[model samples]
Target: MCISNPNSISDQTDLVAMKARLWALLRKEEHEWLQKSRLKWFKEGDINMKFFHLTASSRAKRNQISKLKEIPVKRLSVGSRRLLERLFSEEEVWNMSCRLCLIEDSSFNNSFISLIPKIDEAVSPEDYRPLSLVGSLNKIVSRVMARRMASCLKEVVGENQFAFIVGKQIVDCVLIANEVIDDLSKKKKKL
Candidate 1:
């Protein structure tokens, strides 16, 4: 007579449910191998808090172990001087967008001052004013150009890159445009 393990069916079902839940939870932020390895580790009872903490620390020390492999090629550096330089080049490429928008130098200056208020306050007024203007205008122009560049970029880099660029550009443009619009509205109110 052959005897079946009484717990086998229930164990399998529980495992499936646990895997589904983990996958659902980490779907947005997990790479394929990380997901698979995590599920396997979990089945082996290696993902409890103490074990997980140790694993995470060990993983962090390793050079090639990435939880999310789909991270962008370019690091998103905020307020870097190199970022400013890239913005400058982006603006030059989007000269047509600037021409179409008719954004003035003075308005650009004011916008830049408002955009990076922390940075502006740190610098002397004379030095800050010109730098702020150029930075702000470049940002605005880059944004406008980004929209036009999206289709071309999408063709080359695929949808994700295009989406990322367009999303950032839209946010930047909307912020500047809203500020300008609000000022105009206030002026009209005074008049």
Candidate 2:
């Protein structure tokens, strides 16, 4: 009817309004269909076959452990009686340290490298911090060595070395340097 009356502006406006209403109703119906599809029918089987397949394949890939390297297990020569000894002697500590250094067994030195993200969404290599998860035996040995060397640490290391010392901090050195700089720059220096 609007096509027949081409010059009627009122008719053209009414036609446009009707078309808009139809389009709105069509969109509403499509949204309802999408919601209904997601609720009940989607549980039985997905309407979007491509999307379902993609999700399934991605999940499978994520779950699958690919190219896992074989780690060979080796038995230690040390007896269980000596290994489980509660008392620590100088000889035992020395022996353990020497054995750890010379041992070809990967189990003693094996470590898992875990990447911890520095930011919420890590993009590059620099965004992650690599943390090594070492074996319990290795940690025990390291702790024992550290404890043994802690007494001699102050004697071996100088007073100027503020890092890795139990009683000292690097911030102390920074504060001292700042004070020295301030004193040196003064008109009447007392440094």
Candidate 3:
């Protein structure tokens, strides 16, 4: 059992105690008594912690988000009523083409809001941070849509962009910028 996760309660103890326990188990000569126990057929042996760590469990952590960094927010919650009224009344803007916007699952939005701290515990529906509870069907659909859209979006996007574009890294972007600056400086010096 301890072979699976060494950091478990039993494995975290001193080595001396474990060795003594193993030694006692080994010294025992009786066999009939083992038949009554749950692990009757199990063979005990030396544990290799390194071997166990090679594969990880697929389970998510118990209601915990690891290593959350501050995420930036844009636009205030609501604009002035006068501004909204003016926009609504504008004939030029209204006559132009219209596009629809969408809101993803509540869970998806709550996942972000929950990361931020609040002065009081969540009591009302608004206070509660939601977890994504979308069905498996929706998850599959989302994945397919993402794959299909990736190629289409790629053609229009610049090579330098990394934000929200799957697998791109800020570190790579910064490194490229540094290299360009260095090369430009070298050329300027030569001139």
Candidate 4:
């Protein structure tokens, strides 16, 4: 129905206001649903309104704290705090670092062996390959040692040795051998 009087202007304004309120309520509802979905670990792009409502209600029920108990608080004294600070001083930490040795202990040097299937269907033991997963401490220690050794590698290693040296590959020896062979074949020279 069309209002043809002065009330038409006021009716248009009221309609705009109602539209804005409706949009605001819709946005608020969407935001609440999104939060509930996240709490239930639901991913986007899925239309699961029933699941979202169920999870939201279940979460609301679970989150309600029924107990009302007063917990006793324990405060540490100044002298005890000072003693703890003294016990964990920089000097004590340095001493501990210097004494950090786990070479003799097999427990600390323990590594896990994981069997990975070599074929699609591994029926026999030979079909599976064993991979050693070393401890993080061992990897860190070895990497540190390797980095330290790498700095002095060039000075210690000779020019003829190509493998394990920086910017040199074992294939370089094969190339050099091939060149020598080609030169000998062309000139018919003695070794």
- Predicted structure with the largest lDDT when compared to the true one: 2
**Model 2 misplaced regions, further than 4 Å:** 1-111, 118-129, 188-191
Model 1 ranges off by over 4 Å: 1-136, 157-191
TM-score of each: 0.22, 0.36, 0.27, 0.39
Clash pairs for candidate 2: none
lDDT at residue 97 of model 1 (Cα atoms): 48
Full ranking by lDDT: 2, 4, 1, 3
In model 1, how large is the Cα lDDT of residue 165? 51
lDDT by residue for model 2 over 1-115, one digit each (tens)?
4377867898889889899999999999999999997786577457777778888899999999988888753433245334434466777566666655644465765778999
Q: Write the per-residue lDDT of candidate 1 for residues 1-191, one digit (tens) a residue.
A: 22255478876777778888888878756677788887878875464677777877787788565476575454323443234444445555567545656545656534433333346346555443243445555666666556545434433454433235545554666778899999999999999
Ranking by TM-score: 4, 2, 3, 1
Candidates 1 and 3 compared: the better one by lDDT is 1
The residue pairs found clashing in candidate 1 are none
In order, the Cα lDDT scores of the candidates are 0.59, 0.74, 0.51, 0.70
What is the clash count for each candidate, in the order shown?
0, 0, 0, 0
lDDT value for candidate 1? Answer: 0.59
Report residue 41 deviation for candidate 3 (angstroms). Answer: 89
On lDDT, the stronger of 3 and 4 is 4
User: Across residues 1-191, which tens digit of lDDT does each residue of candidate 4 receive?
Assistant: 35466468888887788889999999999999999978666553246777768878899999999888996545545654444344334564444335554353556557899999999989999999999988645665555455445655655566778977978999999999999999989887553
